[model samples]
Target: MTGAPTPVSPQQIPAAYQQALRLQNAGQLQQAAQIYAAILRTRPLAEPCFQLGLISARTGRRAEAATWFRRALEIKPRQIEIWTALIDVLDGPERAKAMAEAQRLGLIPSDKSAAAMRKALAELETGDPRKADRLYRKALEAGGDPVPLRETWARALFDRTETDAALKVLAEGLAKAPADPRLLLTRASLLETAGRIDEAEADLLAVLDARPYHPLAWLALMRARKQPPGAPHVATLEQRLPEAAADPEATRYMSFALAKALEDQKRDAEVFAHLDRANTMTRRKFPWNFEADHGFLRDAIAAWTPRTRGQSGAAPIFVTGLPRSGTTLVETILAAHPQVAAGGEAAVMTPLLHPAVEAWFSKGTDYDAQAIGQAYVAGMARKLGAASRDCRTTDKSISTYATMGYALDTLPDARFVVLERDRRDVGLSIYKNLFRDGTHRYSNDLTDIARQIRLFDAAVAAWRKRIPDAIHIVDYEALTADPEPHVRALLDFCGLPWDPACLTPERTERQVHTLSSVQVRQPINRGSVGAWKRFEGALQPLIAALDATRYDFG
Candidate 1:
């Protein structure tokens, strides 16, 4: 041998481990993560632990990063850099304590307000926006201009679905600093989510005017309007590509924006190229954990074994499917009925389901299926009472697909209206869009996305077989092509009286928070029925992967 390897690459390091390091250096974090995880399964190494922490940090998984760093520390307690990395991702008193220890190792300047800001961010991420609001206000009160925190605070509120409040926060910031691009962009997002597309476009344009070709602003612009084939923005996006090279994240957004612009122009090859670059960046940022979700399905199926359906009426209807399927459209249709309140893509069920069936087999938490169901119904009835006097509701949370068994058993009257679309279309939609960071982890890679769809179909098929009567199929193709019959059938299955309102779901008066928000506003059309054919050349790999699934949607 020439010489022994370094500490991180000791002699006889696994070939996989070396490959992971090379991939990590090349910015292929997701692939590196796969290799690192596999290596850990076979053998434990502190270096992989540290690398994982760094990877998690880059992906914005603070808690996960801290966990990996701590594991690294456990293996090699005196690694100063590992301690520093751990401190970087910690929050609140934990961060403070870690910093206090790191101080012993070296001199590092501490930002006095960072702890409070971190604590506030923790509150927002965990869904305690009120606490975050208070923390931000407290930070502003103490001293200094709190303008920097304004965008962050507004984002927290927006994430919690407090659209009006979030906008108000941004408006307040804009009042003081009228030309702040960050505030303008944040406001644009708020307007978009609130279904004020024109207003959002105006804000986005303002942001782009102040900071030309701003990457995220460009993406927002695409969503806000339909561009013609040689739109001015397309040329601007192309000419300014080199200017955005400094920020990889920004570059990714620019690619997505360019892709959208090219797509409108029907430049399929160019669209595919940009999408590949943007989606590759997304995968690096947040690697998908296929085994984790796979395990959830396996465990969930085991925990909630097959059972017959128990029935009720005009109860909560959960419209669910893979993202980009017709979940939003179905919910919009159901909401058109005066009796239904559309709770668009909300996580209300997450908290409720966890107490009932989340890892209960391992933890042995005592749960009452019927009582939980009763509680969920009562809670939803009260929750949607303001939206509808009858308190009938539609919950289109994607999690509905995963937790249908527990939900159906618990909510005696609840119905599941699942959308069935061609998996290729779903995969194409997922790959083409920029979803929220944590929303669709597998979306960046088409092969991974194909696997996700296959597994999703498996789960849905299982659920359908178990409780066929309780779950209704809304075929996306058929509904979009000839909507009236399907809409009537959907309404009928959900135990609602047919009304003319159901025929025009696009006219719904409910807050829609999905990528299809703009699409759903248009009259029901068959435009996207086989839109995946447009990308046949670009999507051959994904197509081949999916073709193996042997699936054809109803």
Candidate 2:
């Protein structure tokens, strides 16, 4: 309809297929889909259907494409390539049905290849990643060339937090498929997470060279350079990011890369521009609204509020804000106090009160106010490893306090420290950090990152207005510029007597699973405060927007 839907003949079909692939590669997804659909409508060919299914999955219409693929397989049953498409399209129940159908017709070999895949899928669905890892490994042992199986096995292990094993698997795969972009990228991610930034750079650069438009690879390369234990590669990344951003997949990552680079250079405005582009791309690609868990917060508050009547221990000091916001610094300082044992960013509250939250939100069920409070105290004792009877106070710090009201409502006795930093700095740090997907995708662009930060800021502000004395706002700049005084004030707020040991934060031995792992080890500095100023000219739009919103942390 648009471009005279290229007429197909047997002679012209191959060229049409190649042209369709080129369109798909260039992010002309709708055009490519039309071509593939045209090719399949008349012929019902396995190749076209498989290609169409892949395009559909990538474009987020996997279910509809899966139907066409099933129809194609009905005609030509033994296409190995179709199996890959099949796996991409099928989910939990659909996957089992597809695998069984594949086996019954001898599409997959009778011995365990089909069964193993089903087992792995089941294990993954049931929330048993370790079992899925073992099943994927077993699938490889039973014969097929081991490329896909090994790749997925590594992912399963990585999901289970068995990083060393995951790295080993990815390393073995990379050795065999040196030029394979997926293998190279996976290894790069594993290395990056382990703080092997220099090594990760090599893999990411290789991936970019092979598939220069791969955005994740570009972003990874950007991050690997920015916080290198070695040298910064900002110039190289700057040259390459535009090229990557020209492609859709790489564009989101480029947004973040640009933001981080600008932030590192103290060009806050440029950082925001990059972040805005990233958010726009993300919304275009995957549009959805996420409702805040306020009802959950409300129920939690109702449960805990009654228990705090005329009763208090040095209450659980909640250290919360955006992920990279010096939450660990707050915890480390408090942990140094004789009274506080750090319950490092545990899932205690969510797990304990999640059901009550769901019930209240879904059915308006009444919840026991006192039991909710008592349950949380017990949950903290269990997770904090504090003796229930001997505990005077235990500090529980979960960065989820970006939702301050919900937390305050649930645990009214709980003290809160709302960490604050310049939005550009916070966003830049987030983009540079390797978060394990989900909400971390917000940091993939300056606009989305800015929006999320604004949302959190707005939420916190509203909460503070409602309960002004309930929370303490901690500015990262203040903490960095005057560490001792701020630390003393924070300790005093948490009702802990400050120790001189709290000042030498590096001396405290604790696992900080954040991008600032290296930064926190250094003595406090004013380095990050004005870091976004360097790219001021390029970042004017973002600066104007910030001014318009009046989000000045200064």
Number of the top lDDT candidate: 1
Residue-level error in angstroms, candidate 1, position 112: 13
Please give, for residues 1-554, the per-residue lDDT of candidate 2 as tens digits. 25545446654554566577678878898888788767654455566676677776776788877876777677656555576578667899888877666555444544676579669856764546677767877776676455556666676555445678888887787787778777788777666655566788898888877865566776766655443322345666667665542234455677677666665565554566666666655654443343343333444334332223322343567777876777877776766665666666666666655665566546777566456666667666644342324543434344345334445555666788888888766765664554544545555544555656765666567567656777898899888888998988887777677688888766665544455654655566776776555645544544554556523111
lDDT of 2: 0.63
Backbone clash tally for model 1?
1
The segments of candidate 1 whose C-alpha lies over 4 angstroms from its true place after superposition are 1-166, 306-314, 354-358, 361-365, 370-385, 550-554
Cα lDDT tens digits for candidate 1, 190-241 = 7887779889889888888887857789888887767898788778888877
Measured over all alpha carbons after superposition, the RMSD of each candidate to the real structure, in angstroms, is: 9.2, 8.5
TM-score of model 1 (CA atoms): 0.74
Clashes of each: 1, 21
Q: In order, what lDDT does every prediction score?
A: 0.76, 0.63
lDDT of 2 at 381: 60
Task: Tell me model 1's lDDT, rounded to 2 decimals.
Answer: 0.76
TM-score of 2: 0.61
